[model samples]
Target: MSDSTSDFLAADAHAQRRYAPLTRVIFRLLLAGLSGFLLCVPWLSASLYWVGWFAWVPLLFALRDTRPWAALLLGWVAGTLCSAGGSYWLAEFMVNLKQVRPLLSTLLALLFWCYLGLVIGLGCLLYRWWVRRLGGWDLLAFPVAMVSVMALYPMLFKTHFADGQVDFLPALQAIDLTGAPGLDAVMMLFSVLIYRLLTPRRSPAAAYSRLAQGTAWALLALWLGYGYINLYEWDRRMQQWDTRRVGLVQPNDAITLGIPEPATGFTRESPPEMLATERLVAAGAQWVAWPEARYKGYFDDYSVRDSYARAITRHGVPLIFHDVERRWVDAQRISFNTVALLDEQGELAAQYRKMLRMPFGEYLPEPWSWPLLKGLTDLVFGEFLRPLGAGSEHIAFDLNGMRVVPKVCYEAAFPGFVAEAIHTDGAGKMLLFLSQDNWFGETSQPFHHGNMSILRGVENRVPMAHLINNGPSLVTAPNGRRLASSEAFNRAELLADVPFSEQAGGSFYSRHPQLFLNLIYGLAGMLILLAGWRGRSRVRRRGRRCSRKTRPTGN
Candidate 1:
């Protein structure tokens, strides 16, 4: 061959080699992204389930061959997509509220995505790091490290996956003995194991085949075991107080009542709510639940309370009204959402102010950010607000022979909070959830909220009655079985006979929460540090040996 031609060919070969690695990296990233998007579908479902968590296995496997930073970036992308897709409900709420510009809302959406993706990527990175140190140990340690961090990271950020719905009950139950942190560890570890098994570099065909077969069997066993256990629990614990007719008055009132955008504002003077309650009571509702913030006007007044009392006193039926407490701040007063329980005589029985106030839309932690926050709050026309102080106590009231516990609004998401309410009141019977979901009418908010109640029901082994102002009013059996649900955006009442039982067999998690999940991760974290130290020592010893071997002392 001519010299020029030979040189051309050689240059071409070098160029191809240089770009090949980048091409492969891109391919792997694309694969990971596709896998992540698909997996996120379930997590972002109307119910916000984690059914697709299994897809992480394929993505993690694809990431293993890449550089550490590349793995992190890819994981981040996947995580972002997942979070954005899963939590698009909040983004949609922002859009409806018209608070922030669409561009800013999109940016915020992506920011949440990135944050969650970072957790996913960090999990992959931790798995890789542990794999590098202990080699084969990545099968267990890597998953443990990644899941532990991912699970805890959400808690630290105050947006834990525990609050999400769809299969969380099963997921939590699967990890009940281990706790969520440990369950996270187990999930990640299993993914890594699958990844390692699938990768040709890590395993031979026969071993891969064997491992795959074993995995299928193990998974099948788990499914059957879970199905049986769920059934067993249902039969044993799913009893409720017999035939106590509940009158759930779903007054589909505008959520932005006092805020803005011309809601059909109602006060105690609004006869419709009173009429509806009377209708529900006449239809055999012994206890009537009004929607969240059911009052026509600001309800922090005695006269309003007296009027409400008189109305219900005439019916001789207990009424639960979700009211708001608004105090003027600057030109506008901030409003707090609250649920007030009343006796048949209309006397205030118990009240709970909402906790877990919405972020960005609610009060900013810093006073300086009020203007920025107000700009955002203007979407819903709500006054940028301050959080109501946590309720001093949980209300456990005895109606007839049943002891019932009530949770207000989003308080159902926090298991500890709900448990505290149930146990502290010394009244562990049935569960009552009073919420106002009129803000995001017919959106995924109500469904997502309903899913949280499912988890609460299963976790506490208590039958729950979910009463909402607008949307998805339903009752769940102790085993997380849905009995009946009211439609969204309907002005109506529902009647369900909830049976109450005194049997209190605490689940595994109820007995020892932090110990099963948190402590194990703490120990695993310590172990990773220990493994890293050992790895460093080994590297140093090898370096010293190499240096001596190549020394010029003999020459």
Candidate 2:
């Protein structure tokens, strides 16, 4: 070969070496993106639940042998993409309901998506650090790190890796024992097992991978067996429990913008909600409920309050409805998102003030509340962001000798919060969730919200009547079974036979709310300490070898 030809070949090899890292990075990013897309599939539609089982496989491959920071970046990429896909309706909700500009709404949505991504990124960072410190025990390190981040990191919207199993009733039965985080652990453990099994034979983890794989399979089998048994037992108990006829009203009303003013009296002779209530009563509903903001006027107005009472009096049944309560505090008018109950005599029986305030909707938090950004916030949100006062106590009402716990809009999203409320309220026999989901229109937001609320009932083992405006309202049994439902953007009245068991206390999860999470925290802390100690011992061994090699020796 000529010298010129040899030079050309050398240049070609140099170019490949120079661009190899870039090519590899691009490929890894694509894999992460694919994983993100898969992660969102089950959330988009329940029928695609199978996709969630293997969704994280590509992301695991991408993190293999990667540096700590690089692993975080890849995890963030996957998480952000997944959040963006799953919650694409957020931008539209902001623009249409909050009256925000399209560009600003898109930017805000992107910021939230990135914020949620931090949880996954931090998990990956921990996993990489643990792997480096404790050798190649991917099975233990991956699940612990991921579960810890998921359970510890706080996000505006709480989503679990196990949410994909929402439609899988048998798998969901375990949540009653350990809450959703346990399912998250199960999902992660199984994913890591699959990752190890598929690893190449020459890889370091391949030798003991079979042992780990066998153990994982055995655990999974036991878990599924427990799920089946619990599901059957819950079904049997529900069948034997007494049933109460409840009416759920879905008004399908358009979300009115701006803060509403106190009305002098009922404006219309017969509002659609009142008419729906009357129909439900005629259909043999013993109790009735209206969705949040269904009564647009302030209940503090005596005329408006009387009008609701008179309607309930005519129906001859107890009624629960959502309204805004205004009171004078410090000589200033304050508003509360409240759920009011009217007895059979058309008199006020009990009321529950909403405890959990939605971050941007009911109140502003942190940087948004800064005085300097007040003008900008006002321009984007206008009067939509009402700084409502939060309630301090968990309140429950009586209906036909049974305790009914009420939860307002955003309050239903939190697992621990809901469990605590039920536990504190004397282990309520029934749950009533009132919400206005019209802001999200006909998007998947309403469906996702309703599904999550249904899970709360299962966790606590109580019947639930989830009433929503512009829903997908649901009446769920204690076992997470849907007894009745209403379509979105439709005027409908559902008469459901809600079943309730006469148990002395709530489910184990509701009774011991923090036990599972605390256990996870302790386990994660121990593993981190163990990793640090092992890392120090390795360093000491290396130092000893170096010192022995350099020591002077006599012949």
Candidate 3:
């Protein structure tokens, strides 16, 4: 055979081998699993956070030269695997706390994983579509698509590429300017650059590629540089600010049927939490915080009020604690998950009700609350589903003239919610995040929950004390540094000299929280339009060429 014929035969055989069913499936699964593992490890432990910088490289590689539908499938597989691995605590939480059967708990966890996976699948689909229309501009197309999906997609628990970078303090500082979504975009850009560097054959011209890489590195340096500067500035400001001894009490209470036993009753003259509070006060704690749900009964109850009053009056130190608030609204008994403050005299200074209630945990959503499904929901959820009233206002507690804003449980996870709370309360001086994480047990859940407080503090330039009932309570400075922390599942008390600046909440992000996110949305829109225009122009050019070729030799 001739050389060209032999070469063609060889190429045909290679294509056949590459497209074989078993080979393709194995390769795809390997790539997806690898990407998922890389993404999950960082979420499991902060020490592994550096792994997230290139976590998506394998997924990008798998999607290369693949059809949109195939790319979507690969991305979904990777994303589902990542979420399932990282959030394996969910199954345990469901089975132990929510009273779900083992099989049903597993299935629910799977559904949750798949739901989050759709965001990644959609992002991959968009990326492939853009590549087909506008060539391999992964640098721009990939980040924009991923960031847009993460920003727009709604989930019970929101996840972002930046979540894995929570421990990377220097990188986290930029969040004050751009929010988590911006950090996500930056991380995506880094992943794309790494992918391009690894697969030079698939990248742009060598000079252009080098320039892009250089620019990315330069920007990264500037980003970290800004972080260092802010870190120093915040630290300096903290030194000059008024300092007060703050204490966090972790009860480490036992949970039964998803509710903490300590939360329900305080029959003892001095419960463990109260004793801890007394000890902290003796240790010179000017202000103390107790985790959410520690006092479950109605705060209006005379007994409960008396108990809180006795504790606060005895110590003569301001205290913040959580309880259930009852109100008679239109002859209906409505309850609220509330965090309240008591002055030195044990008077109720202020109370902030939890605004963002956990979907199934605290309140049932639309379909579940619908009349038709009420029976099934009630049967399945049982007493675990106690719908609480939502709060309309963000109340701040005054501690020695400093305003302290309070967030209950997962409310701190939301950037806008925390920012609004601070802004609404005249730029609150400190943030007190009250949480009960016992339902999830000693899993990575507590760590993940605590990590969120880091960004919230940094974004608003305020000190934060995240007090959890099941430990891993922490104190964070405005620079995202953890001043003190306790291990999960351990009953512990933490005391840190938390500083509060007279000038609080002037961070650019605090004033204009949505500015960066809106810019990202605009950029994504612009890219989509550009891709469509390019595709249309290509089709028109091809149409003209075909018309010229089909015209008979009229000349």
Q: What are the per-model C-alpha RMSD values against the true structure?
A: 4.7, 2.5, 3.4
Candidate 2: the clashing residue pairs are none
Query: Candidate 1 residues 140-252, lDDT tens each?
Result: 55556665666567531323444343344455454334333444454444555556556665355224345644664476458437745874566565443355777777767
Query: TM-score order of candidates, best first?
Result: 2, 3, 1
Candidate 3 residue pairs in backbone clash: none
Who is ahead in lDDT, 1 or 2?
Answer: 2
lDDT of 3 by residue, 180-244 (tens): 77788887888888887787563344334566668877887888899888878877877877778
Q: Which ten residues in a row have the lowest lDDT in candidate 3?
A: 200-209
Worst 10 residues of 1 by lDDT: 155-164
For candidate 2, write residues 98-209 as lDDT tens digits.
8888898999899989888878888989999888887777777787798889877877777775666767877777787788778778777777878776877675553665
TM-score preference between candidates 2 and 3, better one = 2
Q: In candidate 2, what residue range of length 10 has the lowest lDDT sum? A: 260-269
Task: Quote the positional error of residue 333 for candidate 3 in Å.
Answer: 1.0
Backbone clashes under 3 angstroms, per model: 18, 0, 0
**TM-score for candidate 2:** 0.94
